[model samples]
Target: MITIRPSREGTAVAPVLVLAQITSLQLGSAVAKDAYDHVSPTALAGMRLTFSAMIMLVLVRPRLRQIIARQWRAVISLGLVFAAMNVAYFQAISHLQIGVASTLELLGPLMLSIVLSHRLEHLAAALLALTGVLLLTTSSASLSPLGILLGLLAGLCRAGYTVLNQQVGRLFPDWSGLAVAFAVGACVLAPVAAVTDAGAVAEHPAVLETGLGVALLSSLIPYALDMVVLRRIDTRTFGVLLALSPAAGAGVGLVVLHEHLSVRQACAIALVVLASAWSVSRSPRTAPVPSPAPVSAGDNLPIKDTEHQART
Candidate 1:
């Protein structure tokens, strides 16, 4: 994934990484959704974060004492954001269809892009995205208000994670900030989940396995790819490609959760996609720079380079 010169070859790789990141995250969400009956969302989220943290810790073994003193505040904040975003997303999927939940959550990044870009096209895209979200949610009266709220909350967390993670990435080595954040998030959630939902895992080891799978697919591989590919793409292009994630989530939900999308909803998704693509195609080119590499989890996962992708 190393690109010595920022050329067309390097640019071509960015979208592929983002696409892979989207696919892995949505598939992981389906797996986590399937496990919800045996384990509560909180428990599943806690387990996923804890297990990912453990894997990363074992692999990275960051110099905690030195790193902590250097950037403990940002590290701890990023971890909390990660934990909250995952919990909110799971809660949303519990009440709403995964497609709708994911579509709603994209609001965070859409808004972020608008704020950061300050481009009329981005503003137009945000409006288009809002229109799409309205189409997706209003068409189905069965959707839960609480679930939609939770998804929006998760989106907000995601936006914050993107902003803060950029700072943390600048402060630490490859994946070290992420390792610490995951460890901190795991430390925060594991005990509460253990006391409340330990029996679910004890009774069914499959839940643990599923969570581990989620961590691997959702957190480890995609984020690693994200770290590499992001350096070759500008933030504008990266954010625009992010429009693919909701569509991917919707597709995964249809296949896995048997969630169906209406014609209007599909149109809505398309509008958001078009808005992003249009904005990206119009934007002036910027030479990409290789940024720090870090592994992160789902939406709340630290995006060490470019914009942070939404966590499921």
Candidate 2:
């Protein structure tokens, strides 16, 4: 169990971080969809991972020399998950309708949070979100069965990445955990994807620009903001706020991507927002204490970084 310190800074920083993560993710996806018009989604995904990885590598200077064998295993696992998640998700978005596909991608995290919360109200919230997802994904009567399968697999991969990150964050050094994962993901994706889309990158400069936008919106902004927030909130509470991500994506799509939501979709967003608010409100006002990992789990777990903040 993770103990929560009231982040003295979380009050000011958490919301900002949440907003940053949401908008960045939204713009990234929207920009990516735009990019697919020029380059294959695989190539675009590669570019985003590559650039984001570079930015963090330049800034953080992670202690590569001190890395342990176990840490290397953890890092590689996280990197593979991240790479698989990105490539599959980008491909799904390329094939399926954007709104439906995105909602699908979000399923893994939403389910994890709800299941892990183990609360009745959260169960209902999960159902609501799941129902909305069903509607969103299945509403397209002609939707390709193969596309849906790919999307759900991508969602599973995303869940794996998220779970691994939580544990990795406890051990690996700060954003270096994410940074290394993204770098490895980029390298793995680049050679295979770029070769196939070689002509697209050169033929369409706009394609490359879209990929850059995706990098900025998705990877670069969110990780830094998450670092700020992680210093404040426990992993569990952090997951709850993450539920708002899809709603943010919806808003972003409407404003920036010009993808309007139907009345039903609008209603779904309202339900998800309300449910998330209630889940957070009902949880303990003082953040839960971060428990030290079981001795059997490992001796090398990181000391949880806790900050005290004024209540919002």
Global lDDT of each model?
0.74, 0.68
lDDT of 1 by residue, 166-267 (tens): 566655657777888888888888887888899988999888889999888777776556555545554445555677777888999999888888888888
- What TM-score goes with each of the models? 0.85, 0.83
* lDDT per residue as tens, model 2, 40-135: 878888898888888878887676666666666777897788678888878886676556666777777677766676667766766666666666
What alpha-carbon RMSD in Å does predicted model 2 have with respect to the real structure?
4.9
Ten-residue stretch with the least lDDT total in model 1: 303-312
Best by lDDT: 1
Q: What is the overall TM-score of model 2 with all chains considered together?
A: 0.83
Off by over 4 Å in 1: 1-12, 68-70, 229-237, 292-312
Alpha carbon deviation, residue 196, candidate 2 (Å): 1.3
Model 2, 259: alpha-carbon shift in Å?
A: 2.3
